[model samples]
Target: MQPCVLTSTGGAPVAARFHAPPGAVRGAVVIGGAMGVKQDYYAHFAQWLSEQGYLVASFDYRGMGDSQRGSLRRLRADLFDWTDDFDTVIAEALARSGGAPLYLIGHSLGAQLPGLLKHRDRVDGLLSVAAGSGYWRDNAPQLRRMVLYFWHVLVPVATRLFGYFPGRKLRKVGDLPAGVVMQWRRWCMNPRYHVGAEGAPVREKFEAARFPVVALSITDDELMTERGTQVLVDCYANAPRRVERIAPADVQARRIGHFGFFRDQFQSSLWQRALTQLQAFRSPGETRDPADGISSRVAPGLLTAH
Candidate 1:
């Protein structure tokens, strides 16, 4: 892995790492992370993809992880700002791909922001893992009470007193910029999440997105539920998509939670499934839409162990 720094359109410095394969590269991929999660958390997965012969890149958004160079109290960033970061990373990936297909592997919040990308159409395909709308009501029943406390109580109190959400101290996700936390809170409080929060402009962008997408929803995820995942899939109205609701048993595992799918332990199982989807983009004569058909409904039996 090689360290790299990218500058967003707004001039914020974004820290990133690039992994190149030993042999000829098949394609280029940019791994988009969940909110508050650092890019280093994905280093192992990026390396694994590199070993698979793809040039992979992972980056940290400004005010988070290695990108945060100054005081958190003075930092200001929102969802759109992070999207600009992704754009920069995507542009870099495309430039280095030598005309190979460029793909996105977005996790959670990472997956949701691609609709806002100015170059969304240039992407060959997208792989969304545990991606969903963050409306508290749409979350898992086991997490709804905590979600309510987070949005109604914790976020307001923390951001007001600290100028940022003290998520690290609170043991909730990770530390987040005040603007990002507040804007996300506004979206989660609404049933429509980002689509409802940002309104018509974002919705129109989602409608215009024509890239093929594979959304993987974990059955045992304590954060995002089936409805949450579907809400995000529904936003891409014009895109051909396949929704896979994967159970731990499918991979012969006991539990694969929202974050477990990316862990090294599931490399042979869940991670390989993601690679299959990425490889599909490079398959000979493959069209944007799959030859079979596209369905938004959950395909529980589609994925099997290698």
Candidate 2:
């Protein structure tokens, strides 16, 4: 893993980690981190992809993780600015890919924002995990009530008082910048999610993104609901896409929630499920560990869409 700095459109230094393949590069992959999740969290996964022959890059958003310089309250970046930062990484991946296919592996918020990026055209494919619309009403049944309490009370009160959301201390979505939290709260409150919240300009961008997409929505994911996933994927009206709904039982796991797909246990199961889908478009070396002797449990004809 090589550490480097990515200069954001706003000129902030966003720290990044690059993993180079041991042999030939199969492709270049840029990981888009979820809301408030540090880039370091994706370290193992990125390295694993590199070993599978893809050049991978993972980085922090300007106001979070290693990129968060100075006081959070003083930092004036929003979700849109994060889009620009993600674009820099995407552009870099494309440049270094040497004409190999480029894919965006986005998780949750990372999945939702790719269409908004300036370099959306550079992406060869999008592989979204636990991707969904975050409108509180469409949240998973278990999260609906709690998210309401968060949006109606906690978000307004906390952001107003602290000038930024102290999510790290509160243990919600991790520490988030004021603009990010405020704007996200607005989206969560709106029925159409970012589409309705941001109006037609944003809607047009989603409509304009033309690529093949595959979204893996976990049935047991506590935060992302089926309806939310459908609505979010449907926004990419022009893309050829698939939404595969997988249950914990389907993968022989007791529980695979919103964040569990990245845990090391899924490397032969969920991780291979992802790589298999991408490999359909680009030729990648076999990454399975025969020692584990585990093949992909995501059987064919498991609720895929064209």
Candidate 3:
């Protein structure tokens, strides 16, 4: 793995790890999960993709992981900053790989950010794991949503006064900024805000650059709900998209939720499946390990527009 850096539109420096095939590269970029997520968690998957003939680039968004630091905290970052960081990473990946066709594998919130990047046309395809369209659906219950909203309102004040919120100690909730939290809430409550790459707002000119897309969701994901996943599917403006659901019992190694898909004991299984699907699109006849293939049960299908 080679370490590298790139500058975001915000002027923040980004850090990334690149894995190249021994021969000429196929193409792919593997993005880690949200806030404070480390690429080591997906290290095995990175190496595996490389071995399968892909030049995979994995990175830390600015203000997170090995990237250079700025004045922001995770919970404090808004969507715009994240989008800029993603574009920087993609640009770096293009430069390093000699500007080959690029496929993207984005996990959780990271999945959404890539689609939001200004130059998404550079992408040849997308694989989104545990994708969320930014809303909770009915799972949060009206009362709980209100309480969470109120808590989000206080997060900024509390962090400012106390220097930080409790971090990730809150059960099942991610460590995030009050501003990001509120922005997400606003998107979720409004009928407009889309989740994952499906929800990100794109410029009209870039809308025609539809590449093949695969969205996989796990059953019983506490952080991402089926309803939310369905909503995301409904909003996608792309053709030839697939959405697959994985049951916990089928999750080979560890029972994965939102974060666990890339971190669980059975990560190898998930990677194998996803890699197979990705490789299937590389050329007309490239084949990858089915063990690396996404579950047959959770396979993505043709995505219909609403």
Candidate 4:
């Protein structure tokens, strides 16, 4: 992987990395990182995809990771602006692919923002890992109390006093821009998530998404419960969607939590399964159904909007 920087349409310098295969490329992929997570977290996964003959790009949002130029106390980025960052990266991936099909591997907050993509039609398909609504009530039962504390206490207090979320100092997640954290808190507090938080225009945009999406939810994920995952998938009212809930035992592991999917430890078992599903979309007129040829056990179809 080589270091790169992307200039968003809005002019923010987004930090990124690119992985290219030696031989012919089958497809181009843009790996979008989760909230408070840096692009480097997905570096190994991106390299693996490149080895499989795919050109892959992994990027960090403007206010996070290498993209941030200075102190978070002065930055003022919001979650919606992330759509612009994604647009820039996707455009770069498409340009590099020389017109090869482009796919997205979006994790957590990475997955939720795709509906806002201005070039949604350009995407061949999306693979959403551990994607779900952030509504606290919809989280895993065991984590709900913690979620409440985070939503009601930590976020507000920290953002108010520090001018940004001091997640890194608190050892919660990672440091976040004030606007991003507050906006996220608002969405998570709403039952409808971003749809409710942003109102009708956002809802319409989500309904406009018509691509195929495969949402992978881990049963052991303490952050997102089954209902949390389902709620986000349901928002894509016009997408052909499938939800696959995998238990750790199914993969011969004791635990695969919210962040484990991208770890190198699962590169052979879980990661390979994801690659198969992604590669399935490489050929024209290929099966678009998420269930076809995927090794992971498929849960009941979540929401398939016609």
Assess candidate 3 and give its TM-score to the true structure.
0.77
Model 2 residue 132 CA deviation in Å: 0.2
| Model 2 lDDT tens row, 144-186 | 8688789889988998888899997888998888999999999
User: Estimated TM-score per prediction?
Assistant: 0.92, 0.91, 0.77, 0.92
Instruction: Please give the TM-score that candidate 2 achieves against the real structure.
Output: 0.91
Candidate 3, residue 172: the lDDT equals 29
C-alpha lDDT of residue 253 in model 1: 92
Worst 10-residue lDDT window for candidate 1 reads 291-300
User: Residues 1-306, candidate 1, lDDT per residue (tens digit)?
Assistant: 889888997689999899999998777899999988898889899999999999999999998999998877898888889899999999888777676677899999999999999879777778999989999999999898677878888999999999989899999988988989999999898788888988999899988987777899999998999899889887887777767899999999999988888899989988898898887654354433322322122122332211
Clashes of each: 0, 0, 12, 0
lDDT of 4 by residue, 217-250 (tens): 9999988887888899889887778788999998
Q: Tens digit of lDDT per residue, candidate 3, span 183-284? A: 655665544354432243453322444656677888767666666665554444553566788886785444677777665366467777887777654543
lDDT of all predictions, in order shown? 0.85, 0.83, 0.61, 0.84
Using lDDT as the yardstick, the better of models 2 and 4 is 4
Worst lDDT 10-window in candidate 3: 291-300
lDDT of 2 at 153: 91
Whole-model lDDT, model 2: 0.83
